[model samples]
Target chain A: MDTLRLASHGLSKHDQEILSKQLKMLRGRTACEWVLVDDYRSADVTLVQGQPPSDMPGIIALASTKAGKSGRYHLIEWPIRLFGLIDLLMAIELEWPARAATPLPTLSLAHRLARIRQDQWLDVAGMVAQAFQAKDEFRTTVSSFDELIERLASIDGASVRFVEGHHPLADQEAALEPYSLKAVIWSLALREEAIKSRQWHISQQQFGIATWPLFGTWETAPWMLRLAALYGRQPATLADGVELTGLRVELVAAFLHACELCELGLTVKQSTRPPRIESKLPAPESLLARLRRKLGLGYKRT
Target chain B: MISKILFIGPMGAGKTTAITAVSDSEPITTEADNLDRAQSDKATTTVALDYGEIYLDEDSSVLLYGMPGQDRFDFMWPILAEGALGAVLLLDHSHPDAVAQLDHFLEAFAALVSCGALVVGVGRVQNSQDIGVYQAHLKAKGLALPVYATDVRHKQNVLLLIETLIANAELNEILER
Candidate 1:
């Protein structure tokens, strides 16, 4: 394996020791070897805790404040996670030139962060794939919408929640005992749409009146097609539609409006049935909420 | 006041989809089976007009009118254009004669185009060259209307075209006053 010579500047002794241990641990998992060097000029990467060495070629700053500054360096926030550091190093190695005289990697720190994120996403995707493949009760793929719905129905208590943490099939979860299987399938469909838009908060509510007749010539999520098939049998209110379809209220409203435009969705009177009692269990917190708690994304919820 | 916004485009340019995507209510469309397969492969074509309404606020709403694309029905172009806030001219970049189509529509809607009440939305463009061609064409005509790379099927993009048109119209109205 090729080795990378690393040097440090401005970092505390404690941070240098931590970096050394992390380099050793990461070496076992990744192909590149990292070695600490005495001379800054000979080092392939220079980890800096404060001001970056101006003359250095390969500088990796460990401060968030240094982010976006023009320099030949990468920035990982002060408190670095092991995985994030390893990923950043690998990114640099991939981008490094063979000759020392060559210019350093042109990939920006932001681009490296995006690459690391994509790598983590792939890891999670592999785990999800393996989990689904291991399950004998659920088929990994379904050929037809009917087959998909029938298979989903076979799984008792099958509940599929969107990335937003809203369970579109929450109402059906109790009725269907094995909802996790359905959740897996729904997640795959939601993932497909999320990939297309790269925006996760787009719900049926935001989509407004465009979410109906789920199955059409237009490119749409497969889960939506299944939801439309089910809704074709019976019409429900905006709130219940959200619960049953796992789409945001706005998106569902849009679908219903599209159906109305196409004369597809049937008009029905408001249900006289009393509102279903919400579960006493606190709603599952969203990833956004967890991220907000951790990073304080510069805004507060009203 | 309710402002009317006309959506004009050639056959299969997604005019109906754009209106339906952003319309606050169910859009009323006068569509018939397309017998002219040579012109477009779409199953249906707008014969007379397509109508939808979108409220910007409680006090004001925009009425969306989509004119029939075929030149044979050019008679309705000005009729629908009457008393309108602006026009959103959608072009299919994938079409072989898209630039020519732009010129034709620009001539048809010259009144609106001259008055700063028109915004162009070019859909399905694969590269900047297509946009450059549109820009050059508009430049040659001494028009400075906003041109957008859009997917009319997407609500936000369609809304952007409408919003730009409205903003331009308002600006022109203020200048005139």
Candidate 2:
């Protein structure tokens, strides 16, 4: 087995040696090589960084992955480290076939869309489709209303609309129009089976939003006009589809919201509940702790 | 605020361990080792919910509840999970039939998932081979939930597990706005 190390701004000679020594046991004592992908281009290095890089800000380094044959790369940052280990074990089990590529491009594209767009109420379906077309890691799925609003806010020129009096979100929700044409497009792109059956069609078209826009705007659009745009709309079904990479459904929504905020000049107000603490019963000693006591064995509480 | 929770899994999947891990006091468990009708393998299984509590911040308390892992006790799930804010689905990766165990619990309880519940999967598979196999199996179930290889032997590990689930749950709630 081979190992690699990646650093923030490329790896130093010292960092390379450190990773090699740390992973010396990766391949038993058999023949192994340590390659340093200084530019962070190698797919074989485990890219670990404390916090995120200053340039990348909120974006964390994608997990390490092996080099693959097919262009069908599937790099991922599994929420659990065990999964990453699983990837390695699976590779070994499969005799080290083409590596699973990380979906870094898609993630980068998502972040770029999020940080660079400005739109007022962008179309969810269109944005998701575009994301998939670009081979990003965000798949179109049933999303929370708040996610849509936040993503829109992240993009430029995009804004969410709330039902004039019925909106429940604070500043973000109060500003959105109840009926949106874009929501219909979104519903069509996702949940194809449901759309084909015409199950979520009405709700899809009649969807209302309340959230901040990607950009701010004071102009109020007429409800009747917005409703007209929503009228005569049929359920959205999956016509053509593209697969996303290894990101969570919620993450996709957040990335999309970020993109919308950047692309559209939409702004919104939101109402949120203060974090409430839930009360409960008392705690119990762990079975392990109990067993140690019963056995009269000293166990230090670390 | 009582943060309601539910535990769902097959018999002997460690739901009690999870509840007991974070509970502030001794967990109230209904162990059914004496019931003649109980499955021989599940003789010492938890029959009803395991109730306990833990505090995070001054204003919030996380109420812990565990559900019976047996189908015979399925009738009590609704009552046990009446106001549950989320759920923890235990996966006995060490079991000979891991997939079968998951199907027994999750396949039939789609309602729990639909109610905006945050279900975290705890897989106890130790062997690397078993871990990979179980990972693929979990993916096949479309659980889409985060899974971790956990051991309840350490309090710190247990705390980290709970925190991870809580963070994810909070992230969903925040995004749901």
Best by lDDT: 1
True contacts kept of 2: 0.00
Query: Model 1, B1-177: lDDT tens per residue?
Result: 466789999998999999999777899999999988777889999998899886645655668898889989998888888888789999999898999999999999988877767778888976434465786677566565556678887876776566555434433433344
Worst 10 residues of 2 chain B by lDDT: B166-175
In angstroms, how far off is A3's CA in candidate 2? Answer: 31
lDDT of 1 by residue, A8-43 (tens): 878778877877866765564444667988677888
Candidate 1 error regions (>4 Å): A1-302, B56-60
Per-residue lDDT of B94-173 in model 2, one digit per residue for the tens? Answer: 66766776566565566655532434344565433344354455445544333445555555445544443343343334
Give the candidate number with the greatest DockQ. 1
* Native interface contact recovery, model 1: 0.00
The TM-scores, one per candidate, come to 0.38, 0.37
DockQ for the candidates, in order: 0.05, 0.02
